[model samples]
Target: MTNPYAASGVDTEAGDRAVELMKQAVSSTHNNLVLGSFGGFAGMIDASILKSYDHPILATSTDGVGTKVAIAQAMDKHDTIGQDLVGMVVDDIVVTGARSLFMTDYIACGLLEPTRIADIVRGIAKACKAVDVALVGGETAEHPGLLKPHEYDVAGAAVGVVEKDKILSSEKVQVGDVVLGLQSSGLHSNGYSLVRKIVADNNWQYTDLIAEFGRTLGEELLEPTALYTGVLNKLLQDIRYQNKFSTMSHITGGGIAANLSRVLPAHVSLDVQRSTWQPQPVFQVLAESAGINLFDLESTWNLGLGFAIVVREDSAASIIGSLRELGVSSWQLGVIEPKPENAESKGYLSSAKGTHGGSVRLVGEYAK
Candidate 1:
């Protein structure tokens, strides 16, 4: 009465039950644009929507949650990690000023615990619904021999559409652009390898009560990443802001300067003023514990800002004001200018990500 596949390792029944438990949450994210029902081998979305565009360009991004998953596993928490996944994947699509259409996730785990798998997908569905992106389909792969039962990883791909002319990039950057920063919700989903190292070296428990955070260390670290798609897309939809912005930077693994460099032209140089903002308490604590200087932190953590928008200087006030109204704490982080003559001597990084781009440097000191 035993199937050979089940006998070997894969649990077909558990996978099915995980799908069943996650069906409602997943279906909740789908709109009429999502064609076909769940359980389809390949997900379908109505591409006819693109006909309305003059020149619709598709933007696709794939990303994983990274070592932050270790914290989730350590705390036995899975729900909030999905938002991190959505933020890592869909936000990249939105960086191109694209409207996210749909997303698919893949989970690789040694054993498929139906409830745990359902929790992860439910989180993904919740985040997708927030951004109005359909959760069309997903897969859960069981790797019994390669991974332990409790060990797993999550990644996803997002699809979005933007008019060709509206695509934001470094090519649109002009002199005197105002660089605005969007606040992040804790560490988001990057640099957790170092975060874990700090925690382990200090022998800190995930449940350790830290006064600065006012919550357990694990809760603070596991705080869901902020979703920029909904807010950024909302800003893009407003006619008043048309053609006022050039490019955006999503501060992830590369930190502020490196990621911002990804969207800059070769001739531009930007010095992100650290005096404009202070590192969050969590960052401060980690830095103090690790005895590393602010520069090292800058290369790893987001510090405070999670996303940045480079806009025309004239629109700086209005854009930051709009972000405030949208409940996003934003500030003028810096300005774009002609490349400084002393950029190389000043240690500006133009090719941090290995692309031919503008130079960026973190200058001054973070406000105390």
Candidate 2:
């Protein structure tokens, strides 16, 4: 018997198969702390672990994969996008020194493609396992008419817990602190809108290779965001980094200047040296081919540095050395200086400050 719903592009059977395919991957993220089985209406995580803290504060963040999914779809790659989703969501929680507990993902698509759905979930599960976050539950919505058959969007939310007093923020950031830059794998999920625009303008296919990039454009663009949770979590436990690690700025949508400004106080300013570390090849290529000015490029992309750490001046070398031991490359970009009360700091202060924003200026020239 032919199912009437199948004719409309929605298949309950395929949905079931997708769940069946992803069950093992999802279950692998669970530990004794996760309650119940894989399929559930709501994810159950044991919060009893929080009792270990004097006062545990829960941190939650949700984010989508953005236009980067378009690149993934162009090349028929689904796995890495899920990691991008986790990187966008979970990494934000840990920015406040929170240890990620569990994550849930939502997938919306035109039809039920079990293999594709499973591939996405597998990527999320692999990332969750790497950082000890439980993948408790997820929803795959089959939007039959709204999206094209191969079109889908991925978003995820993560929950974490941190001791009340141990929470990290800009409040801890002070003048004389050293700012360290964490090297990114590639673009790390931002600036994709401009990336796609550039590719379209240049008539470049995902499979096309540029001499500088070595691999196909799709391969470089699809490089998953570097997950920092595991390493940062270790650093948080060490006494040397305890108070020295004041705050962090996850270089995302607004680039280095805007993001660091979020964690800087009004009285302080972040002076970033552009030449301290090399900008990734992708960003340099985009600037040369697209004719994007350095400042405009900084506003749009991470420009190689993914995450910024603010620490005491004495601790910079120790922190940088520790991060290197963990395979995370870092650069000592600049320092936190007092924000001049008058207009003398115009060029040094980035005007992107919000109420909490501080002056952030990029000094020095790009390392050509």
lDDT of 1 by residue, 239-351 (tens): 98999989998999988888998899989999999999988899999989999886788878998889999999988899899989989999998989899887889889888
Best by lDDT: 1
Q: List the residue pairs that clash in candidate 1.
A: none
* lDDT tens digits by residue: candidate 2, 1-368: 99998888899899999999999999999988899887989999877898899999999999998999999989998988888988888889889999999999999998779999999999999999988899999999999789999999998999999998988887888888999999999899998999999999988899988778899999999999989888899998998877888888789987788888887777788778988988878888877778887677887798888998888899899999999999999989888888876623376544454545678878788887
Off by over 4 Å in 2: 343-345, 348-354
Model 1, residue 181: displacement in angstroms?
A: 0.4
Q: How high is the CA lDDT of each candidate model?
A: 0.92, 0.88
Global lDDT of model 2: 0.88
Candidate 1 whole-model C-alpha lDDT, 0 to 1:
0.92
Stretches of candidate 1 above 4 Å error? none
User: In angstroms, how far off is 319's CA in candidate 1?
Assistant: 1.0
